[model samples]
Target chain A: MEEIKDTFLHPVVPLDFQNNYRVGAYLQRYLDGFKEKKILGAKCSQCGRVVVPPRKYCGACNLVMEEFTELPQEGTLENFTVGHVNLEKGQWKRADAPYVIGMVRLDGAANAMLARLNVSPADARAGMKVKAVWKDQVEGEHADLDCFEPA
Target chain B: MRNVGIIGIGYTPVFVSKRKDVSIVEMISEAVDAGLKNTGLAPEDIDAYVFGNMATFEGVNMPHLWATEHMHARGKPIMRFATGGTIGMAAFHGAYYHVASGMADIAMAVTYEKHSEGDAQVGLMGIITPELMAMLSAGIDVTGQSGMGAIGGGSAGGISFQASSYLHRSGAGIEHIDAIAAMERRNAAKNPYAHLKDPEATAEKIAQTPMVSWPIRFGHICPTTDGATVCILASEEKAAKIADKVAWVLGVANCASDATTANLIDSQITDPAEQLPAIMASKKACERAGIEDPKKEIDYVEIYNGFAHQTLMYLEKVGMCEVGEAHKLLEAGELEMNGRCPVNASGGVVSTNSIGTSALNRVTECALQIMGQAGEHQVEKEVHKAMAHGWGGLMQYCTITILGDKPKKL
Candidate 1:
C-alpha cells in the first residue's frame, strides 16, 4: 500500500456574478400597492386562488393570474419558528436575541407569506390572528410592509 | 421499457467532513475505480456514463468534463444532471434510461460531493440569491427585519418551519425527532462508509444538543460529507451474464410540484409538510412495480432524510404508513433494523450526506439490501423488495425507485 500525504492549498478566485431581474408586471403591481398601505394579491381565473406578492402563473391550475385583488391586513399565523442563530454566507452566528419568523396567511389570500412577527418568541403560536405593520414613511418597496404583529 | 438491474456499486473509501488528501477529480476517481474493480470490469466495459453533483458547492462547472479520464468516460456518451440534493438519484435514473432505452447495455451513474471545497450555505443561498438581490435593488433593506427574517436563516431556518409544521400536524414532538436522530446515528455506526457513527446514541443524548431553531436541534441536522458513489446498471441479458447477484429495477418514477413550497421570493402556496410529489411518485412507482400495499409488500425502505424528522415524515407521505402514524411506529420500535419494516439500515442521508451522492446512495443501499450484500448493517428480515426515495429542488421534486430480488416478469 502506498502511503498518502495530506496537502492543503487555498487559492483566491475572485469572481462576482451580477444578475439583473425584471420584477415583472405581477410583482410590480403588488409592490406599488404597498405605497397605499394595501396588500395586493393576484387571483387565478381558473382556480380562484389568490397569491400574495402576485406572480403571472398559478402552477396548480396552469392559468395566468390577471386579476388583482386587495387582501385584508388581518390573517392567521399559519406557522412560525424562533431563530436563535443567523446564517451569514452559510456560517452560523448566534443572534443578539431570539426573533420570530412567521408564515402569515392574509385574509382572502390562498397562500401564506413569510414575515417577521413582532410578537415575542414566547407569545408566538400558529393559528393566531395577526395584522400587517407598515413603515412610517410610504415606499413602494419590500420594507414598506413591515413585520406582522398579533392582531 | 426493458428491464435494468444494478450490477455493481462502489463507494469512496470514506465519507467524512474533509478529504484534504485528494483533489475533487482524484476523489471521484477512487469511486470509479472501486466500481470497476468490484465488477471485475475494465474501463471499456462501460458503454455510457451519467455524472451528477452540486457544482456550486465545489465551485466547479461541468466536472464530468474534467473527470472524463478518471471515470473512463473518455470517448463515451456522458450526461450531467444537477437537481439540488436529488442529483445523485437523478443521475442514476438517467443511467437507467440509457440501459432501459437499449442505447447502452452497461451504464454507470457517478455522483459525488466535496463540501470541503466550497461553502454549502453559500451554494444553498445561491438558489434564492437572485431574488434577494432583486429585492435589495428595489430599495428593500435585505439586512433588516423584513428581509432577513424571511430568507436569512439559511437552510436550517427555512426547514425549521417545515419541521414545526410537521410536528403540529403529525402530533409528534421534538422528542420524536431526537429519537430518529439517535436511531440513524446508531445505524451509521454499523456502516463502514457512513460519516456520523454513534454506537451509543440515544434520544436523550440527542435532545441535549442546542436548538438551532424551534423544533430543530443541531443533532437533527446532517453533516456536510465528502464522498462519491458509483452504481453500474445493465440490461437483463447483460446483468445475467456478468453478475451473479443483481438488484432488479422494478419501477422508477419522479414528480415535481411548484417551487413555492420553499417559500423563497414569494409566499408558500403549498404546505411543505404535505409532500404531494412524494405521494404521487411513490404511488406511481409502486403501481408500476405491481405493489398493492407498500406496507405489506415492501420489505425495506431507504428514505433520503437529510433531517431526522424526514425519515418519519416521508414514511407517511410515501404511504408506508398512515399519515401521522410514523411516530407511533417509532414508539413501537417498528422502524428499527430488527423491526418489521426496517428503514435506513445504512444509516440514511441523515447520517452520511454528500448532497450529490445522498440520493443515489439511497438506491445503492437498497440494492445492497436486496442483493444481501449489506454485511454489518443488513436488516434481520430477508429483503425481497425495497423502495428508495429522493427529495430535493426547493422541496418540490421527489424520485422513487423500487428494486426487487428478481426482475419483473414480462
Candidate 2:
C-alpha cells in the first residue's frame, strides 16, 4: 500500500481550554456561609467521616451525609507535585518551569483538597501549612478566595 | 499454563509526535497490515477482534469507531477496551482471553491514538466533580490540580513539593529517573520508528530539559503520540503452523478505579495497583498453563513506561521487588537491555510513546524478540519468556500480559 502522510505531521492542534466551573445550589449555600467566615463540612450518618467542601455522601461508608456544620478552615498539605509546566492540549508547557501543585487537607475531614498553591516552586514542599481565603459573602462566589497561597 | 502464542503482529511506523498525515482509520490499516505480514497470514484468517482507545486523546465522543470497520474480522465478535494510558494492553488482554477461553480459534487486538486530533485537557477538565469546579475559582487550570496535591502532601518555604514522604519512602532518586530517560533516549535512537529518537541522546540532555512536573522533565515524561499497533492471537495448534517461532500470551489482566481522580494519593499507597489484575489473571493463566516460578521462568519484559519512573514501579508492583528496591535495581543497571532481565529492549514508550497503541506495541515487541525479528533493538540473548504492561487514565487503570515460548501442559 502507498503511504499517505508521515507520522511527524501534527504533534497536537494547540488550543487553550478554560471555562467557568459551577457548583450545586445546596453547596452554594455553604460557599455563601464561607463568605461569612464560616467553615462548612458534611457529617456522614453511617460512618463518622466528616467531609469538607461539604459532600452529600460518605464515600467509604456508602452513606448519605445530611448533617452540615461549620468546620475549621485549616488542614495540612498532603502528597503534591510542583508543576513548572502547564497542562494544556494534553501537553506540558513550562510557564516558569517550576511551580507547586498539591492536595490540601481541610481541617476535620478525611478527604484532602486538590489544587495549586501560590507558593514559589522552591517553597511548595509537602507537609507545609496552608489556609483558605474567602470572598466577601454578598458580593462573592466560590472562587472569590482565589487559591491558597503560603499563609 | 496452556501456551497462548501470538500468530500475528503489526504496527505503523512509530509516529514521532502528533501528526495529521493519516486519519485514525488509515493508521489502523497500516498496523493491521504489519500484523498480517508478520504472521505470514491474511486478515481473513482471524476470527475475532478487540480494540483499545483512550477517547481523551481523540476528543471523539467514542474513539475506536475506526476499529469497527478498519481492523478486519468483519461481523465476527469485537470488543473495545480502554483505560487511559493502558488502553492498548487492555485490548490485548481481551484478545488473549478470547482465544484462551475457546471463544475463538484466532483473535486480533488493535489499538491506536490520533493525538493530533483531540483535546486531552478537555477530558481532564472533568476530573473535579462538577460541584467542585463551581466551588473553586474561574481561572483554575490543570497546573492548579497538581499544585493541590503538593499543598496537601507537605510544606516548604518555596520549592514545589512532591509526594515527599511517598517519593522518599520509595527510595528512588533523581538519578533513577534520569537513568530511565537516558536509557529510553538511547533506545529510541536505535528505533527509526520512534518520534524523538535523535542519535545524540544523553542523560545530561534529559536532565537539562525543561521540568514539567518537579523531577518530571520533558525527556522523562513521554510525548503525546499518534499511531497504531495490532496483535493476532491463535490456538497453539494454529500458531505452530506458521510462526517459525512464537511468543505465547501466558496471561492478561485489567483493573480500574472509581470514576474520580481522588485516588491519586492516599489510596495509591502502592500506586499502579497493577498487581491486583496482574496477579489475578496470572494465577488463572498459570493454573491453566501450569507456571510455577514467574520470575525464574519469565526472561524479559516490555513494560509500558509512559513516564520513565513507571518502569521501576511496575517491576516492584508485579511482585518482583520488596517495595523500593526497583529503584535500586534500576540505578544499578539491572533493568537494561543487557541486564539480567532486559525490559523494553525496543526502548519502550519512554523512547517512543504511542498514546492508544503503546501496550499492543509492547506485546508486539515481545513477540518480535521471541521470533528474532526485532532488528537493531533485539536483545543479545535468546528470549523465551517476556512480560508486557500498560496504564493510563491518569495512572488509574492497568493492564499486564505474560508471554512465553510454549503452552505449559496444565
Candidate 3:
C-alpha cells in the first residue's frame, strides 16, 4: 500500500457575537457604590456572612442577602499569584513584567475579592495589609476601584 | 434500576496534537467502528446513543446531528451533552441512565475533540466572555494591568489561583507538582495512545520548564489534542451473553457548586481548592457502590488532572487520603503503577487531553484495568475495583464513576 501525505485546508468563517446582560438589582447597587468610593457587600441573612460586589443569594446558607454593608478599603491579602504571562484573546503571551494578583479579604467582608496587587511580586505576601486604590476621577465602573496597594 | 456494565471500549489510533489526515467526523467514526468491532456487536445491537463534545472548540454547533450516520445512530434514540471538560463523563452518565432506566438494553457513548480543528483557549475563554464583555462595556479596561489581573491568564490564570490555594492548604511545595508531572509523563511513555510520552521525564527536568504563573509551569499544562473515545454499555443480561470480561458500573454520582466559587472578578467566597463538591460526589458514589473505605477497597484511580497538582489536590478532595497526605503518598511511591493505590496508569489527562475524550478515557482506562486488557500501562496488582473522576465547569462540577470487576449483587 502506498503511503498518502496529509493535505490541509484553511477556511475562515468569522463569527462575531455581541450579547446583552442584565447586572440585576444587587450588582447594580454594588456597582453604584463605586461612585462614592464605597465597597458595598451583601450580608447573608442566615449565615451573617458578607460578600463584596453584593450578590443576591448566599450559596453556603441558601438564603437571600438583602442587607448591604459598606466595607473598609483596607484588607489583608489572603493569597496571591505572580503571573508571568498574559492571555490575549485566549492566547498566551509573555507579560512585560511579572505582576501579583491577590485575593484580599477586606475588613468586615467574609469573602475575599480578586484584584491586581500594586506591589512588587517579591513584596506581595499573604496577611499583608493593603488598601483599595481608586481612580483619580471616579466613575461608576468596575475599573474605578483600580488596584489594591500596600496600606 | 437495571445493572449496567461497560462491555466494550474503543479509542482512536492515536491522541496527538493534530490529526491532519482525518476530518472531525471521520476521526469519530474510527472510534465507533472500533467499539463495534471490539464488542462483536453491530450497530443493530445498540438500542440508544449518547454523544458529547465541547462544540465551541470546533466552532460546530449540534455536531451530533452531523455525526449521526457516522456513529451508527441514524434511527436510534440519541441525546447530546456538553459540560465544559466533563462532557465525556457526562455523556457516559447519560448512556448509563438509558440502561439503568430500563429504556434500552444496550447503549453507546461517543465523545471526541478535534482541538486541532479550532481554537481551544478561545473556546475556554468563551465560558467567561459574556461576563468579561459586560465588564468591558461597564468601563472596565480588559487590556489594562488590573483587567489582565482580573482575567488572570485565562484558564491557566484561574487555575493558577486554584493551584496556589491548593499548595497553601495542602502545605505542598512546587516540587511535588513537578514530581507528579514527571511521573505521569513517564507513565504516558508506556501507553501507545498517549500524546506526551517521556520515558526519561524527571522532576528536575519538569522543574526546569518556564513558569507560567507562581505555581503553574508550562510543563504542568495538558496539551490540546485530537482524538475520540467510544464506550459500549449493556444491561447485565446482555453483558453476560456478549462479553466474557465486563467492568460493572457500580455507582455514578455528580455534584455542582455555585459558579461564583471561582468567579475571579466577583470575589470568591469559597476557596477553589476547597472542592466540597468532589468530596460530596465521591462519598455518595462510594456509598452507593458499597465501598465503605475507598482507601482500602478501591484498587485503582484515574483522576481528571488537566494539571499535575490537581492529581494530588483531587486525591485529597475525593477522600483517597487525608487532607495533606497525597504528596506524602507520592514521596512514598504509593501512587505509581506498582503501588498499593495506583493512579493514572494510563498517564492521566495531564499526559494526553482531547478535552471531550479526557474524562471518558478515565472511565475506559479503569474498565480496561478491570478487564485486564490494559496492555503496557497495566498495573502489577490485580484490579478488583477502580474509581474514575471527571471535573469541569469553572471548577465547580465533579462526576464520579465507580467500577468493579463483578456486578453488584442485588
Docking class of 2: incorrect
Q: CA shift at B389, candidate 3, in angstroms?
A: 0.5
Weakest 10 consecutive residues of candidate 1 chain B by summed lDDT: B260-269
For B151-250, candidate 1 gives per-residue lDDT tens digits of: 5555676677678889989999999999999999999999999999999999999999998877889999999999999999999999999999999999
**In model 3, what is the error at residue B210, expressed in angstroms?**
1.0
Q: Residue by residue across A1-151, what tens digits does model 3's lDDT show?
A: 9899895322122344432223456677878999998999989888888999786556565344679999999999999999999999999999999999989999988889999999999888899999999998888889898999999
Segments of candidate 1 deviating more than 4 angstroms: A1-151, B129-143, B262-268
Query: Residue B118 CA error for candidate 3 (Å)?
Result: 0.5
Q: Tell me the TM-score of each prediction against the true structure.
A: 0.71, 0.64, 0.71
lDDT of 2 by residue, B282-340 (tens): 45544443557656766777777766776776666565555787777776777777777
Chain A TM-scores, all candidates?
0.86, 0.69, 0.87
For model 2, what is the alpha-carbon lDDT of residue B90? 76
> What lDDT score is found at residue A136 in candidate 3?
89
Could you give the DockQ of candidate 1? 0.01
Error of 2 at B231 (Å): 0.5
Model 1 Cα displacement at B234 (Å)? 0.3
Candidate no. 1 TM-score? 0.71
In angstroms, give how far residue A53 of model 3 lies from its true place: 56
